[model samples]
Target: MDLALYHPAAGYYTRNRTVIGPRGDYFTSPSATPLFGRLLARQLMDFREEMGYPAGFAVVELGGHRGQLRQDVLLEAPDLAYQVVEVGDPLPAGLVGCFLSNEFWDALPVHRVRVAEGRWQEIYVREEGERFADEMGPLSDPRLEAYLDGLPVAWMEGYETTLNLQAQEWMVQLGQCLERGFVLSIDYGFEREEYFSPHRPKGTLRCYHRHTLHDDYYAHPGEQDLTAHVDFSALIEAGRQAGLEPTLFTDQGRYLVGIGQELFAEIAERTAGQFSRERQAIHQLIHPSLMGSAFKVLIQKKTS
Candidate 1:
């Protein structure tokens, strides 16, 4: 999984077509609409003001692809130190402001597991004549079983899913990196109960190829993008362990509406016959049926 996504030479993200638009494998919330970055900039500015506009106030963005969100935010709040962090780059030292990322966690490699005959087992992938196949066996690591320790006993019977300990570990590392500030993560996922529910028999892993979603995680090698839905509960627990306190958690639609309701209204009133693309973009971002409800906003804070 790691080699397929992050392998130095041929990984999906490290290739020539590294983007979130039509040419890329998938579309993210921010790339869906410029308004996503515009409205989000407003909130980032608030984070700055809440911290009394400290000097060297950096807005460090992880997985900041070509500075899309950073460009949008800095357009409005140019005073803030904007840094877009790519993989293998050094993290911002002693960051004292917003540490933001969107759709970053789901891309990390995960351990696939399933309940086999009343006991848990890990799913393995092997290459066979240029094609990949799964080989089920004993749990790859002890922590794989421990990952399910908190699930409801009944749901564990036939459940198959991913266990992403990397996300939790990242929260701890991010918490330690930020001197004193907010951590804002935006992604598509659910709380613990829904994530581990019996109703979701297929788990939450998916692959994207040219805007089409599929379940062929092992297909196309490094050509397609693979992702799994994030488990916010584990992230929260990890943050708490790292002394990062939760400030807000809500659907993206609600959070954006609350932050930009008046602005959207004014833009609507001002542009009567323009048939603006910007308007459509913002609509796609906040409409409940689309990307809005599919994404969530999590904000945590660390002080002193």
Candidate 2:
């Protein structure tokens, strides 16, 4: 299962030409508007100033879909060194600028597990007449066993869950690569408590196809998109173990407002046009009810 989704040769992301936005499967914050990138640039510039504006600091963006955000950052700050780290590859070592990822962790392949009869079991997928079906297997991975140990018994019982050990592995690698500066992660998720809360019985796993939500992830195989909600607590803990310090944790709206609200307000006030569609699009990007609140921003600083 892991090889199918993350293999360097024929993975969904690597082989497929289009996988982001409404036309492909779903839309991300960057797909919403340039405002997201612009606001992110504000945060990056702040880090640059903090680092004394190094002559060649790199703003490495992981999972840079179509490079729209990278283009936006370049347009806003041409002097800054920008690098896009493609998926399925290790992060560069000895970097001195901010690292960013939007909707990246969710796509990582997670091991599926379930607890039954006071014991945890791995869930495997088998080919069933040209379709995939779930099968029970032993929990051979120690990390997965440890992950289940932290969850409540009720939440684990008979409920499907994803042990996102891959995300943790990625963080360890990221911490090793980042010599200094921030690791900024923007995605839709919750802390460990809320993530495994009783309110969420089936766990945070879903599929997207042409903007329509579906639970039948096994239906499409590599044709549709599958993602699991990130465990922000795990990400932070892993970063700490890897020598990164947690700096800021907040919802996406607050992060944007702190960095880009002023710019957006100024643009709104100066516009003489009457309710232009472009203005509306920009508003939707930051509006409290839309992508603004649905997303979250987590920033961690690498200790020198």
Candidate 3:
């Protein structure tokens, strides 16, 4: 998965083939509307104010493709400091502000696992005459077993899931670099129970190609996008271990509504004409049936 998505050459993201927005393979909240970033910027502003606007404070965004969110937020809060970092880039040290991300954690490479004979087995990819095939093997790493310790009790035979150990490392990295600030992450995920529920036996790993969703992980090797839903409970626990405190955990819809209800109302009143496109865009962002319910928001804070 890492090589398919991050290989320096012939990879999806590294090859710069990731197209976002209307014509892209998929749409994110920032792609839906600037209001998304605007509302988030408002929250960041509050974070800044609460922290007394510390020196060298900056809003560091992880995997911010094309900077749409950065542009939108800067437009809303012109004086706010902002920085965009790619997935593998070295994060700026001693950051005094927020580490923000949208749909970023889901894109990290994951270890596929399944319950086989009441034990966890890792899924590996092998070459089959120019095609890829899944090959089951023992836990690739002891960390995989440790990370998923005790979670397979209810998983029946053949139940498949993904282990996103990278996300946990990400939290620890953010905790290490952030001297005193918050981490605001927005992505599609679940709160552990739902993530590992019996009802979701198939797990959340999915692929996106030309805006179409499928589970053909082996199709279009380095061209299609692969993702999985995040486990917010795991993230919270990881953050706590890394010296960060969870401050908020909610769906994107509720978070946006809490921060932008009045702003949305004013924008609706002002953009009643041709500019009403933004109003519709905002609806797509917060409407439960759209990207709103599908995405979640998690905020964690750390102090020096």
- lDDT by residue (1-304, candidate 3, tens digit) is 9988888887778887656766768888788778788888899999999999788889999999889999999999999989999956789998899999998999999999988887889999999998999998999888988877877443589888998999998899899889999999999999987898887888999999899999999998788899999999889988988889998998788888889988988987887666577788777887789877888999999988
lDDT of 1 by residue, 22-41 (tens): 77767776676667787888
lDDT of every predicted structure (CA atoms): 0.84, 0.81, 0.88
Model 2 segments more than 4 A misplaced:
1-4, 7-10, 154-156
Clash pairs, model 2 backbone:
none
Q: Is candidate 1 or candidate 2 better by lDDT?
A: 1
Clashes of 1: 0
**Which candidate should be chosen as best, given TM-score against the real structure?**
3
Better of 2 and 3 by lDDT: 3
Worst 10 residues of 2 by lDDT: 1-10
Q: Candidate 2: lDDT over CA atoms?
A: 0.81
Q: Rank the candidates by TM-score, best first.
A: 3, 1, 2
C-alpha lDDT (0 to 100) for residue 195 of candidate 3: 91
